[model samples]
Target: MAALADAEHRLGRGLPDDLRQLLLECDGIIGHTAVDTVWSVEQIVAQNLLFRTDSSFAQLYMSFDALLFFGDNGGGDQFAFVQTPQRPDIFVWEHETDSRRWVAGDLRDYLGRSLAEGGDAWYQ
Candidate 1:
């Protein structure tokens, strides 16, 4: 939990409380029958940083400064938050189309829907 806080502090902002609690419970989740995994705090920071600097992504989307990536769908698609308000909503970034779509209104909803659907693939 301290590690998560440290990562958030380094990023200069806090994660949504639901996400913080989720991370505290488990560093990340491995899909029941899928290869996808939500990233740990460290992994999230690293992945966000990597994407933030990618030249191609920058050319297309300006910047990832307002986003915080949390997971990936094993096939290259990413799950993230838009970083607004008290509870950040979930969005999925499709690798093939280079587009993003809202998945859930909040972390709890995302988890429930993702689990109910069996895995992250349902969103794809």
Candidate 2:
């Protein structure tokens, strides 16, 4: 749990006001979405988000890819993740104080960034 907290702290420092606002507005986002279930309020913290781990989104995109983080080094951190089709591998890009909220983007961003280095894919 300490590790999770530390990771979240690290990520928060890098997040931006926009993300914070987004979080506050939408209660955080997910990389891969699956299911019609509502998440517990406790599960939607600014740092952590809970979404379906394995779903159809993975199958629509090419095999798992990588991701890039756009969070800050300060107190506005965020995260991103790209999962493989077979879903064996996961590429993560994150910045936050709660490791639980380490994933903050969608599959498109994750896959695009995962192929690049340090958020370079965003340029593509």
Candidate 3:
């Protein structure tokens, strides 16, 4: 929980409650084929900053003020929370297309769906 707060403080925004709880339960998820790993708190901050600074992700940079990257498929596609007022929707950023698509309404929904589908490949 402290880690999550620290991350939110660094990010200058509060993360969704469900996400914070999930992180507390497990720093990250592993042993899943569809998702290589869910990032740790530090990794979330670092990856977000990396993407924010990289010119290659200019499309994402131009559109979103902040993105909380949580997971990645081994292939480079990423899963993240998009900062939005309505709800912080989970989005899948396809590396090949350099495009992001809303995949779930919130963290809880995303988890339910991901588990129902057996893995993150359902998004791909």
Instruction: Please report the candidate that would top lDDT against the real structure.
Output: 1
Task: List pairs with backbone clashes in candidate 3.
Answer: none
lDDT by residue (22-114, candidate 2, tens digit) is 444553233222211112123322223212233553444322223323222222233333222222222332222223223225434444453
Off by over 4 Å in 2: 1-14, 30-124
Better of 1 and 2 by lDDT: 1
Error of 2 at 18 (Å): 1.5
Give the per-residue lDDT of model 1 (tens digit) for 1-124: 6898788877778877777888998888877566445778898878887887888878877467777889877888888888754446898888777787898888877777777756558775
CA shift at 93, candidate 3, in angstroms? 0.9
Cα deviation at 35, candidate 1, in Å, is 3.3
Q: On a 0 to 1 TM-score scale, where does candidate 1 land against the true structure?
A: 0.84
Q: Which ten residues in a row have the lowest lDDT in candidate 2?
A: 32-41
Error of 1 at 86 (Å): 5.7
Q: What is the full ranking by lDDT, best candidate first?
A: 1, 3, 2
Scored by TM-score, the top model is 1
Each model's Cα RMSD: 2.1, 14.3, 2.6
The TM-scores of all predictions, comma-separated, are: 0.84, 0.22, 0.78
Over 4 Å off, model 1: 60-62, 85-87, 117-119
